[model samples]
Target: MAAGCQGCRTAQHQFAIAMAFQPIVDVETGLPFAYEALVRGEDGEGAADVIARVTPENRYAFDQQCRVAAIEGAVAAGILDTSARLSINFLPNAVYSPVACIQLTLQTSKATGLPVDRLIFEFTENEQMADTSHVKNIVDSYRKMGFGTAIDDFGAGHAGLGLLAAFQTDYIKLDMELIRGLDTSMPRRMIVEGVLRIAKSLDITVIAEGIETLGEYDVLRGMGVRYMQGYLLARPGFKTLPPIALPGELYAAVA
Candidate 1:
């Protein structure tokens, strides 16, 4: 076993994990664009509860297991029939060998009948990367394998802009703090707008996460954000795909 992946050996004895899915919508289409798989406990506890148990040695196993469970759970939940892709959050550090570690994910995708093309792997911004080149390698390998990559919780973690500069990804989910009170805060709007401009220039799709109100939705929509997620749309469903309910105004606009 690799040095960092020591945890993989004893991971199964430590804890069991599960997935909760939340929808990401396309306001223009008024349909499900993607479903983000969030890690949770087997009994449906919050992600933090399960993640707190991860040690350096076990993180690799934890990361690998999360991927398998997310796919299996989503398949059991009937996500494959929908056009929405499955977006799974991953720890870049847990990836010891990008190509080798991905074999199980590939096998899981085939076993579940989920297309590799429909899989989107997102890295959490909160996890500080020790070796950025490793992350780049992982991203490159995934892309080559026909999976989409994203940066989750953008603007809320260490070296946000620096990470972007290091590698371009398919998507960036704006941090909830940036979306909160966005309807009322001019400065926040401006900051988001600027980020939007940068993303556009780089051809990276931006999804505004943690949207909670019609006002926030409208502001972001008016600002040209095509994708969104959060309570205003749907909450995370335990091993289930929640229905997306777009605001009436958005529905009308799409119509």
Candidate 2:
């Protein structure tokens, strides 16, 4: 193993995983909203570096540890309750072992006494589905268990609309790159509009990610985007979120 990998392995086993809460706000109401738990490795190594050292051979282990740590940390900190939904990012490869992931998550919830329905699993756009049948099966199992699944970076990957049509996703998060500069780009606006239309037809909720300015928020709001996440609302940090209210007008207009 490379020095970095060797060092990371030792650190990974002993490292404390900390949870940071990033508020997912209702685009129209502009209020504090759902909290997505961001995981960080706390062993004097940056998270990016730690993730890089995680190989396909050990990806499942790495991700499971992170998930468990995030849940435990959140519950211990009193950030998770019956009313609060906890969103956690899961790599595509992790879904290959979906049963294990689901089991671990459910076990955490049971141990913490938090409802499984309040946990949201967010998968990135780059995850390749080696077996669609297996992916669907895993999704179905989680749904049966009352957990929600979200596809992250919806527009930037190979899956795009096809994945939405194929998988049963509760939420589709638009890529930040797509949301950036959307106010000035008609093409971008049109693409987002198309996504919103598709999502509505499928009954899937859409969330715009990486909004840094009111201009972007206003443009998305006008485009019928109902949920948003970006620096403008709140950055990802360790603080617990305050109460969040979804904008009634935005939902009405979208409806």
Candidate 3:
């Protein structure tokens, strides 16, 4: 077997934290929307770099810190509110630390007066979750506390379906790769349709990610996608997002 990669635990522990906010728009209405907090290492390094340098023992703590920083920064900047949701990413392992992180996040929310319902915890499909039972328990706990949960990059891998079945996610984000050429590709269209069908059956909201082109947007809208995010909508940056508007025809058709 290949040797296990190590070092990320230490590096992640020492990595500085930064936040990049992306606006989530309602595809039908197109307005200055809720913010999705993106995390980056302030040490001039990416999350992957930090993950590559740390040991597994400390990885969850480091991940929790990054997540807390994102929420704290957003609240401090007055960009987040009780009316608008704040989405923060959480590594699968960090789910086990929900009690601690949730306490901190709740405290931040209390200080900012942002409602617990407006806080969304996002989990990416990139990492394998070792204890899904524990993860589900933690996720349920957060939901009971009025927080929403989402699974990012849905339909990107084998575990995506499992996650959907296991967690009562409030939102399911479609992977950008599956959306890039959706208008022209039957395969991509089929995949998105299938995901939508499942999401609808589960009463979960669907958000199509990486909608950078009109063609992509049009196709997703036709597919009944309700929410969207990407450069075409708004890039991840420090600046506040301007209100977005749908193409006139799109509004007329939906209206």
Judged by lDDT, which candidate is best?
1
Report the lDDT tens digits of candidate 1 across residue range 1-255.
Answer: 365444443345456878999999998887889999999999988988998999886777788889889899999999878899999988988888887778778888999899999999999778899999889988988999999999999999997899999998999999999999999999999999999999999999999999998889989989999999999888999989998786885457666
Candidate 2, 97-152: lDDT as tens digits: 45544566667679987777778878776777766676677667777778788888
Worst 10 residues of 2 by lDDT: 1-10
lDDT of 3 at 171: 87
Q: Candidate 1 — which residues are off by over 4 angstroms?
A: 1-13, 249-255
lDDT of 3 at 241: 32
Provide the overall lDDT of each model, using Cα atoms, as 2-decimal numbers: 0.89, 0.71, 0.72
Tens-digit lDDT string for candidate 3 (171-228) = 8889999999899999999989998998899999998888877789889888888789
For every model shown, the clashing-pair count is 2, 1, 9
Q: lDDT at 127 for candidate 1?
A: 88
Query: Among all windows of ten consecutive residues in candidate 3, which has the lowest summed lDDT?
Result: 1-10
Which residue pairs overlap in candidate 2's backbone? 32-244
Q: Which stretches of candidate 3 lie over 4 Å from their true place?
A: 1-13, 43-54, 80-82, 239-255
Q: Rank all candidate structures by their lDDT, best first, as comma-separated numbers.
A: 1, 3, 2
